[model samples]
Target: MSYEFITLKQEGRVLTISLNRPPTNPLNGVFGQELFKAFSEAEQMEDITVVIITSALEKAFIAGADIKEMAAQDAAEAEQFSKLLQGANNILNRMKKIVIAAINGHALGGGCELALACDYRLMTSGKALIGLPEAGLGIIPGAGGTQRLPRLVGLSKALDILLRGRTMSPQEALAIGLVDKLIEPENFQAEVMQFAQELAAGAGKALGYIKAAVYEGIDFPLEQALAVERKYSAENSKTHDAKEGLTAFVEKRRPEFKNE
Candidate 1:
């Protein structure tokens, strides 16, 4: 399927969704619609085990939300726009497949929120900045940033970033646990694809279960979280891949998981 503001390419079991808006790649209503459409299409594809979200522009992964568009919105329109943003963001967390954010450049405001929604973030080293800067614009992150940021980086640091609307370098983001890995600019895309391909080669159902356990269990109490983990673990163990894995282990061979 084709998208107006995004492009989707699939290679083997991995799908790459690149934001196509030029120069800044600012998020808007159209962007949100197209993103959700791309994700919906991805969800329907049984072969796609991993999804990578990135930008086509070299200077900005996503500069921020489209201010010109927002400036024209009234209360009702703004509320509707927020709903669209939230729906788009929800795909990242609620999808059964893993999503990786390849932060090639600056990701601020809504851009940062988009990255935070992903399961893993691989950012390019150097001048690229990432953070929630909505406070500087007299608003707050309308997506999941306010909730997901603290979950990833802790309350104090999340508050510091949100309140100050601070954008930090890749190194600082890594130190704060915002990004999972940092890659050299020269080899960033190749490394990200390689890492994603490695994940794609694993047991897809098991990976999905792991993601479900972590995401769904996070908000629950300790005992409840363990119960959630146990549920997924038990369910995953019944899959064909799990049986193959055990058989391969006893036979002293690498298991070829079919993602069953």
Candidate 2:
């Protein structure tokens, strides 16, 4: 399959999708459209048990949205652009398979929102940074940034970062729970691939359910969250993978997961 602004490469159960417009992979209408199509396909691919969002270039994961494109657009055009981007962002958040952001370098504005949409984020050490600095650009983060960032970090922290419009180092981001893992710059790709493969090797169905439960339950009331967990647990229990997992445990052998 061909993608205009991205590259999709699959190795084993891990599907690596890299932003192709390098140096600074700036998001645009075309990139948003292609991302929606690419990630939607990834969500449906049973063989792709895990997806890693990364950049092909060594510099930055994504600098932010294309300022040139936005500068030329009118209010109506900008709204349409935001809608497309938000739609794709929602698809990423709701994807059943785990999505991990391999933050090789800077992630700002839309870039930060992209990482926030993922199930997990692993940032490269050294100069790499992640933050939503849209306020500096005279705009707010229109792509799930406002909501997700607050939930990931605390309300006060998220507000402070947004208000300051300052970028954060990888270490600072990790401390605030913005990124789950931090790795050396040289080991970034290898470590991300290994992590994704490890996730793929486990019970795939269970992973999906766990992701769903946490994401859905987070927004629900206490009782409602418990019900959501019960519902997902029941759904997961019906899968053949769940049965095989239990049986393999009893037999004291590694269980083969088919992502059923």
Candidate 3:
């Protein structure tokens, strides 16, 4: 579907969703719906094995929610607005495809929450900042930030930033394990594409199963988690790629994965 705030681009098996409501891709209901549509379609497409989320502008990946929009909402409308945005970004977590958030610039408030939904986050090694700094605005982050941030960076760390509305530098974000990698500004897009291409070329079924194992079992008890993992593993073994991979290993040849 065509989107006013986003653009879809496909390269090989990698699908890149570029948000472009510059000078900062501020979150809004229409943007939320469009984002949900983009990811929902990506989730079902067999040709796309990996998805990259990035901003078209270099100034800000997403600065925050549109304050003017938020200011006009009552409590009920605010809740609905928050949910809309959450549902959109949450698709990144639910999709089996490897989801990478390429933070090209500032990612604060809702922007940070969106990034948190991705399987991994890579940031440009520029002056861009990232955080969940909604407290200073007299509102708390309502888009899965409270839950996901704590799970990602620990309760104390997440709380400290959330309560204080403090923003962190890219280097600081990497140190706190918020962002997985930092690519130099000059080669950020190239490096992000390269990483996505590498992941897209892997055994698709195995990749999906691995993601399923983690998300499905993360909150389960040890035995339950193991059972979840085993179930996915058994399912993965049934794929053609799995058989070819094992056979190639035994034959001492490179396994050619067709993403089966």
Q: Please give the CA lDDT of all the candidate structures.
A: 0.90, 0.89, 0.91
Best by TM-score: 3
**Angstrom error at residue 26, model 1:** 0.8
* Residue 51 in model 2: lDDT: 92
Off by over 4 Å in 3: none
Candidate 2 weakest ten by summed lDDT: 87-96
Off by over 4 Å in 2: none
Winner on lDDT (1 vs 2):
1
Candidate 1 Cα errors over 4 Å, as ranges: none
Query: How do all models score by TM-score?
Result: 0.96, 0.97, 0.98
Clashes of each: 0, 0, 0
lDDT of 1: 0.90
The C-alpha local distance difference test score for the whole of candidate 2 amounts to: 0.89
Q: Once model 3 is optimally superposed onto the true structure by TM-score, how far is the C-alpha of residue 93 displaced, in angstroms?
A: 0.8
- Quick one: ranking by lDDT, best first? 3, 1, 2
